[model samples]
Target: MNVMKSTGKFRDESLDFQKKILERSGFGEGTYAPTSLLKTPPNVCLAEARKETESVVIGAIAELLSRTKVKAEEIGIVVTNCCVFNPTPSLSAMVVNHYKLRDNVVSYNLSGMGCSAGLISIELAKQLLQVRPNSYALIVSTENINDGLYFGNNRSMLVSNCLFRMGGAAILLSNLTSDSHRSKYCLKHIVRTHKGSQNHCYNSIIQEEDDDNITGVTLSKNIMSSAGQTLKANISTLGKYVLPFSEQLRFVTNFVAKKLFFKVRVIKSFTPNFMLAFEHFCIHTGGKAVQDEMQKVLGLSDWHMEPSRMTLYRYGNTSSSSVWYELAYCEAQGRVKKGDRIWQIAFGSGFKCNSVVWCALRTIDPTKEKNLWSEFSTHVTN
Candidate 1:
């Protein structure tokens, strides 16, 4: 609930760039960036990156441990992900050492997986839990902007500076049925689709040195198009597991008609009514354009997108952890309820579209405790 805001010094430093890009970026005035960037001199360095990583990861992990009432030694697996920063001692290793976890704990560090890495981590944890019964897995999602700062005038690269911000989330998953009584939700399905083999999709968002020799992640003009393709593919696979029979039959009928009977463009592609399958949606707050495109493609209404839009306005694109912030926003607003289903969809650099489905296990009270969006009503307009 006590999410840190960027210092004035850092805001002042980024003011010029923000002004230039904010108009077209779909971001509000309140988006966050890291205070570590305000140091005497700023560039990608291990010290600054490490400091930012520890601040968010440790805080989130501490809160998770307290809420779950689980000790660090009880965690049988640890996974931490950050797209741009990978130090000598992995982030997972740092966490294990700092928390003094058990010596035999399985640890994995993931990097360069982009914003969808958080969901990827969850899928990994689910697999690990199946192998080891009655064990807990800790997953941390974060992004460090210290090394991702772009100095060049390349507008595409400069967009990252305006969009990405400091944020992290820690999640604890357990295989024990006993813990299910206390858990907020139960994992139902996870479907991941990757279009990395395609040249255009692979280069849509990439980290490389620009012409000026300044290294940064560049966003290509084809990013939206690439994402759309990946989403289509992902939904095709996911629909089998989540969509209602009526929706599935319609989709199949449309497909058969298009191939067998209709040669003229009479039938439009069927976008299964996802609204029937899930009560809530946590679309990645990648950018304004991406959010808008998703809303239109999925036939979603304004209410369905409020969490994503507001999360972007409040946190900027926190990379992999953005989805969690959106989910927290929904909880703080008292929108979640027992038996309701939530679908989290995330897009990342590999032109990946990943989704995680959860069924609420118990009723969630908005006023039960403070949350990331505890003050959301006072500050956010919508």
Candidate 2:
């Protein structure tokens, strides 16, 4: 399966610029410097965080619905993924309440699924659409980093302070047969891989603390490395399915070229050309190292990594919504085209790795819509 057509929506960028934001937010020097949405203090009350989260969620949904020209009442299913801010009324319920979705609308709230939750939710929506044919499904992925901020000054937790940002994203999915022609892309394939180990690799990055109640999560170094391993395994499994014959040929040819032909390309260095297989790549913006390692491992060119790198530089790591920002950037630049393939890869705790493949359904016209990309494009370097 491939992305036939897809669109993403987020809050306007001018509202939150990366540099000035960190300094004013009281974040430690150079902590939130890399991210546009500055991280707030861990002591920041949950109530304030909840309000901010709801505003972004509502804004994102409204933006998506408006762009897709779909009425809120017409959406038959709603799914939201967020690790922070679990309320008595679930996030999905809140969405239903705000939008006044139909009583018959199917809704769910997913918690504790790490960054991979977004991809997992998208896959779940695809499955639901298949079973309940000809229905619209809305999937929202967001993480309120402001609430989860860690002001402990501990290096382990400090990493989160530097990267994570306040952001959310909403997307629409459908199985309407006609949608195959007009929709973004047909739901091609979704691959989920979890490497739960004895050492609590699947442990929650965000936790509930007693007196020392902290909101933000601490992503351990072990969790990061584990994610890389899981992603490699997952993509390999997915590769067996959607990779085109030409891609397979190039992979094999390159492997043989490096080995038997004694080509300058190192035998150990030869890797599958993910860029050759897909026109666009949306790797997770976990960090600079994560993005760089993925580019080196998968043999992706600098151009392929631009969206990921730029998103990280501008928005920091918005967790689940980061990939959507990258995809939005590509669309804004007029880079996406009809029949183009998009590869979205995300890493999360649970030592989880997930990948989704989307192919464009039609050529898209770049629009100067109200989004993070439009404003931050000039600020970012590459």
Candidate 3:
């Protein structure tokens, strides 16, 4: 009787935690879940999970290929990332088999990299393009929420069940300068910070079985602290590439004064105004709390955060693809202009923070674009 009472209290606490999270998560009613998860009892199985990914990846790729009018045979490289739900043949193989890509096509599948895996895929494609000139690389990013849902009474894991929703993106890249005229953006820089060497950071987010033996991903409170540390480390390198000489010099002087000269109290260190480096920022949309924290840390106005905020409200935290969705939101709003620099910041399970920079190659006309939030543009709240 005593054990039963304690278990019931834990269950109640988990339910209360989930309810509170949902109340403040910034998720809208339209956010999605896989058809399988929508069932009365939530039918979870390997077969159903494949169907969920197939429907998303195929639709995303088919739409991209149709809009760009690119033949699958022309794709020389394929990269796909899903933090969970990796199968035997792999998602890259699935894409190749479905589209019948050429036999010589190079493909890779990335897993367990967390929400930052999308930018990682883009970085991978960029490197592949450097070697194979005039080639097109296709990158796909998505998360399988069906496999990640937690029915156990672990309060930490329940946070994911309330925050993540179904979302994905398909991106096409090319090295052919001839395609420049029609390109939307040009890749500029990438900086990745990994903190897995620290035991706390590595264990901050994990998939494990609870006392009842049901498996789910536990999101420790330390996850946010790990993310904050990674962000500082990532921007340290990224700032060198993007910040102007003036900002860089100021940072260096402060570091030298504080560290080398042993006068920490004499000179105050500060975070550089990233706004001066990029016109837009796509902060990782892990949850509303994360966004709120970022807003305070980065000192961004609502205008700068509009794309990321609206993406979260409409799509929830879609894992790796959230950044692309934020980018699409910017394009749909017609905010992308030629020569404008955009920054994508991503945080993942390795306690990693990664940055990807892009410069707009051409002004994006919203009428011709078909973003997930395109139809709702007229009704999107500020």
Candidate 4:
């Protein structure tokens, strides 16, 4: 990765700033850095943006196409999402042009959707697939950290600089019955809950200029509270679809008792045991605090949280792609099995809590060598 080369330059240029952010941020010393920051002149220009896009999106797409043996012309629809970087030609357009896709191929570029945008793109792809039979959709999720780097002294903004890193993921979704036989997982359900109507939720993560006109994404202090509120709302809806009958009954009973029986202290609040619903979890690698809170809220053990923690440590927060890395980690660890349900939950800037439930269609071998987590297998397995 270009990150290793840039580490020295970053430290030499701004050692104190990097040190301070590292001390407080949940990132380790090995998080990926953008090539933009590593450049001699430190590029944040259009060329740099395209380079980053090509390096991640194109590379991932090539690998996906090669593995799936799907030609570029077969992609009926394409959706690419990036929160901070949206060029004039659009990233989707670039992909279409690079791959020489069919002129009628539907393409969309989603921007400013934040980390949860990956699942959002998947949700969109699922909807599109319903309309177009026997078709495939390509989804690319990435963040341009080079352009998003914050040089200002704002602590809230600096946190983003420390937390976010370079990464991307490309996923191919097919609705063809034939492809289903070969697919690793099947999309079961997607639940998206947005709390942006509330002021705090809207401002929880935002891009704005500091007093010195330096731009950065500022994370608000109320992020944790806002995230909790949104997660509660999201899971409440998600529970009805995925939770077992017995768990649903218990949750409803507790909720009713808490609401109707004001004088009784029988139940404070209904916290459904998410562990009962899903066999595995691919929670967004937002940060240490977010992962810790999610583990506690869902009553997950350290084994269940290994993917999120390890992803954060290894890649930092890759924005929308973090969840994919977590999923990949589970596959590398051989934790995902046939018929096992995996829940991917992510929180975004809109104070959105989005979840996608996937059922493993086939067992994945833990000995896969090409996976991103393959290098860290020893550490993860031990």
Q: Candidate 4 — worst ten consecutive residues by lDDT sum?
A: 1-10
Tens-digit lDDT string for candidate 3 (101-197):
9999999999999999999998999999999998999999999977776777778777778878887899999999899888888899999899999
lDDT of 1 by residue, 1-382 (tens): 1112221122343456657677777676776666766544543467877888898999999998987899998999998999989998999999999999988899999999999999999999999989989899999999988877766656677788877888899999998888978899999999999999999999999998877576778899999899989999999899999999999999999888888867769778889999999999999998898899899999999999999988888788899999999889888888898999999999998889999999999888877856889876656543
Candidate 1 accuracy as TM-score: 0.92
Best candidate, TM-score: 3
Off by over 4 Å in 4: 1-18, 39-41, 262-266
lDDT of every predicted structure (CA atoms): 0.87, 0.72, 0.87, 0.87
Q: Model 2 over residues 220-240: C-alpha lDDT tens digits?
A: 667656766686788778777
RMSD of 2: 9.4
**Can you write out model 4's per-residue Cα lDDT over 1-382, one digit (the tens) per residue?**
2232322223243546656767766777788776677775576667877787789999999999998899999999999999999888999999999999998898999999999999999999999999999899999999998777766666777678777889999999999998878899999999999999999999999999877677779899999999999999999999999889999999999887888887887557878888888988899998888898999888898988988888898889999999999999988887888999999999999889999999999999877535778878767663
Query: Please, what is the TM-score per model?
Result: 0.92, 0.80, 0.94, 0.93
Which candidate would rank higher by lDDT, 1 or 2? 1
Give stretches of model 3 more than 4 Å off: 1-12, 260-268
Model 3 per-residue lDDT at 151: 72
Residue 188, model 1: lDDT of 98
